[model samples]
Target: MQNFSKALLSWFDVHGRHDLPWQQDKTPYRVWVSEIMLQQTQVQTVIPYYERFMTSFPTLQALAEADQESVLAHWAGLGYYARGRNLHKAAQTILQQHQGEFPSDFEAIVALPGIGRSTAGAILSIALQQRYPILDGNVKRVLSRYFAVEGWPGEKTVEAQLWSQAQMLTPLARFDDYTQAIMDLGATLCTRSKPRCDACPVAHGCAALAQGRVAEFPFSKPKKTLPVRRASFLMMLNQQRQLWLTRRPSPGIWGGLWSLPQFESREDLIAALNPSMQTTEDSPASLVKWEEFRHTFSHYHLQIEPHRLDRVQEAPAEWQGQWHDLDKAAQLGLPAPVKKLVEQLEKEDGQNG
Candidate 1:
């Protein structure tokens, strides 16, 4: 275990990432934001988003004071809207309870929304220079292979074993560097596929590599068929060329983001556009059904059918939102699919013009 940490630190001194945006100031707030964004996201993918977010809300107090809509707008297309929401809530919590200071206590930090055990550990070790073991996805892969950990890492028992191994392997000195070093090793060398075992610093002691089962360790979760869902996004445009957009309700998919009005099917959309109680004077002049496309989530697939209603007089009484220019709507916090649709509409408008 001592040699494990020593070898990793030695390797890190030469090869570990040192110039990441979050690594510059190395504050708890910066690390917290980076850790949350890094969840289920690659470091390279997070860089630009993180830089933009920092520019918008540079401090915990700023994040707390900002509106959820603006916060989510910054997080648009990052996926996982809940993280952005929770981050805002947690910042407000800190402002109210912790006097706007990012909590340093381990228990207090984890209590904040979206700050789990692993994320808390990472912030403590990396930014605060505390001695704590982090077991993020990258570290889990590294430890699982190094110790030949079996069973899916998502399983509680398997995760516990990995946590124990992580605690034991964490060194007393330079734990911060060791933490970053191990994560770098997993990300760069012991990758999920075609792992660069030949260049791994700790490959000499990797149980999975020694036993010719490097790929077999860190077993994947049992497979299940992902169910598909269908949706119809209404692209209702007025004669003025402004599109009708609505904010999705919170505590659901794409929560806190502005999106095209969605319905279950074209029938539902048609019914809404031409409600039984409506007069012909309020009806849309033209209705066009665009092709359907698929937008996938982790748990399910959304088969999105887009419908465009042109030269609308007014939105249905049941729909609650505003109408905005297509280009301006695209600038709002929209789901990826909705954003694509907005861009497509913009392109078409350009062609027509």
Candidate 2:
């Protein structure tokens, strides 16, 4: 175990990532946000978002004080929107509970919204140089093959084994770099597919490789069919070309973010809207149709039917949501599908004008 850490650290000295945006001036806030963003997202994808996010909210206090809309606006287009909302909630929690400090204690930090055990460990290790074992997806792949651990990492038994192994191999000294090293090794060499076994420093000790079963160690989650759902995104625009947007209710899909009004079906949306809201007396009676598309989630696919009201009459309060100038709507934190819908509408407006 000790030698394992030594070899990994040595390799990290020459090849580990050294220039990530958050890595420049390591702070718990930055590391915490980066860790959350990096979950299920590639490093390249996270870099720009991270830089833009830091520019907007540079400190824990800034994040804490930001309105949820503003916070989600900065995080728009980065999927797993809950991360942004949770980040904002956690910041405020830190202010109220930890006295505006990013909590260093493991349990305290993990208790924060969206911060799990591995995330807490990674933040404390990387930012505070605290000795804690982290078993993120990258580390899971590395450790699974190195020891040929058999069950799916999501299973409690397999997860416990991986945690124990991570803890054992984690050296007490320079644990920060050790944390980064293992993650780097997994990301760069012991990758999910087409691993660079030749570049792996720990290849000599990898049990799966020794058994010629490298691909079989990190057992994948048992496959289940993703359910498909359907919805209609109503793009209600008035004469002023202001598109109506709704703030999704908290704790729901795209929660706490603005989005086009969603209905179960096109018929349902039309039925709910006031007949007068369809079009103005002076305008044509017809509505405009836009592109229909699908947005896939991890467990479900939403088949969206987009519709636009060319000149909606004054909407009653029951219509809900507010209309925004086309340009201003772009700045709101919208679901990807809604954003795409908006962009499509904006493009048509530009061409028509």
Candidate 3:
């Protein structure tokens, strides 16, 4: 096991991503932030965002003290807004309860708002140099193929068996390098699609490689079809160059984020808009632009149609719509699709004027 660990680490020292910003200083805070950001996100995609986020919220106190809007603003382009919210909440917990320091104990780390066992293990092993086994997708693939574990890893019994194997193989000395090496090996060699067994450092010992089943050991369950949902967004603009936006409820998709008014259907939108449009008797409101866009979530797809109203008598529903300069709205924390809609509307308005 020590020789295997040494060989893996030797390979990692030369080939692994040693220059990543997060790897520069493997503090608990930095590792925690990077791990949380890396959830369901690729490392390449997270690099620039991670650097910018660390700059903005350099310390746990900074993150905990940050307003939800500011935190969401930094995390705007990053999907999974819930992670940002959880990060902020967890920071607050650490500040209030743990004196603004990340917990060193594995169990305490897992007890944080969004840190699970795998994430906790990652932090413990990488930052604290503790021997904790992680069962992330990459590790699962590498271990399952090396040991030829059977059944879909998502199943409880199968996952338990693989985890037991993982614990047995985790070395005590140089645990951090070994942990990262296996993850890197799985990500770069034992990939989900076409595993590069020839390039694997531990290929000689891989049972799946010998059996020509490298891609079959880490079995997956069948995927379900994502349901499609429909919604309507009203892009209301006033003469002051400000757009009307609303804060989403604190739960569900895009929760606690500011966005355009969304309705479940065209009828609901019409019913909601009619009374408000009727109250303002200066001029009749007409739809200046209509466009449809789609945003895909993990379990569903949202098909949204945007109805832009150029002129309106008064703002509806106590929205207190502010008149922001076009450039300022770009900096505000609007969702990516909403930002695109706003840009399109601004371009159209510029052309008309």
Candidate 4:
């Protein structure tokens, strides 16, 4: 254990990341925000979002007081709206329950929305300098290769073993540096592909490298083909040439974000619009049919087909959508697919005019 801690910390003193934005103050608020943004996202990708987010809502009270739309707008293009929503909800929870102070208790910290064991540990150790072990992706990779642990890390048995190993290796002194050092080692040297074994501090003791099976230590999950689903998006246009969009419902994909009106099929959308659309003014033949595209998720593939409905005189009150200028709509929180569709509309209008 001494060697484990010394080797990594020694390497970290020279090569570890020291100048991240969240590390400057090491406040619980900043650490929590950075950890959420870093989930399934690269360090480079999170820097800009973190900067803009801090600028907009610098404190927990500011985040709690802001509306959901405002929060989502700041998180636009980040590709995970739920995290932003959860962060806002957690802020409100902290003020209501914890008296606006970040809790040091493990249970209380983990109870916050969107924060798990690993994230809780990271915040407590990295920011507050408490002694806690984290098992994020980088740490998982490093431990798996160093000890040659087998099976997918997601498995319950494998996860338990990894947690035990992480806790065992975590030193009581300078845990702050140890936590960051292991993660930095995995990210920079012990990478998923093309690991720089020669530069690694623990390369001499790496079981996978010695056994010539470094790639197989962290076993991959079983592969299954993603199921395909279909939906029709009605690109309704009003007299002002503004697009009509609806705020998606929560507890589903793109929840709480403004998006195009969706129907199960083109027939369903047309049926809803036939009553108000004037055939002589805008016939089905004149309707522009944009090319279809697939937006792939982790478990499913969404086939999005965009259909144009121009000069829409009356909106279906049941749909509960509002009209917005294209430029203004672009500024709002729209999903990546919906945003791309808007860009496509912009290009088409420019060419036609």
The TM-scores of all predictions, comma-separated, are 0.65, 0.65, 0.64, 0.65
Q: If both were scored by lDDT, which would come out higher, candidate 1 or candidate 4?
A: 1
lDDT of candidates 1 onward, in order: 0.89, 0.87, 0.81, 0.87
Clashing pairs in 1: none
Off by over 4 Å in 4: 224-353
229-306, model 1: which lDDT tens digit per residue? 899988988778999999999989999999998887665566577553232466536677889999999999999999
lDDT string, candidate 2, 43-75, tens digits = 999999999999989999988988999989888
Sort by lDDT, top down from the best: 1, 2, 4, 3
Colliding pairs, model 3: none
Can you tell me which runs of candidate 2 are displaced by over 4 Å?
224-353
Better of 2 and 3 by TM-score: 2
Poorest stretch of ten by lDDT in candidate 4: 277-286
How well does candidate 1 match the true structure in TM-score terms? 0.65
How many clashes (backbone N, Cα, C below 3 Å) per candidate?
Answer: 0, 0, 0, 0
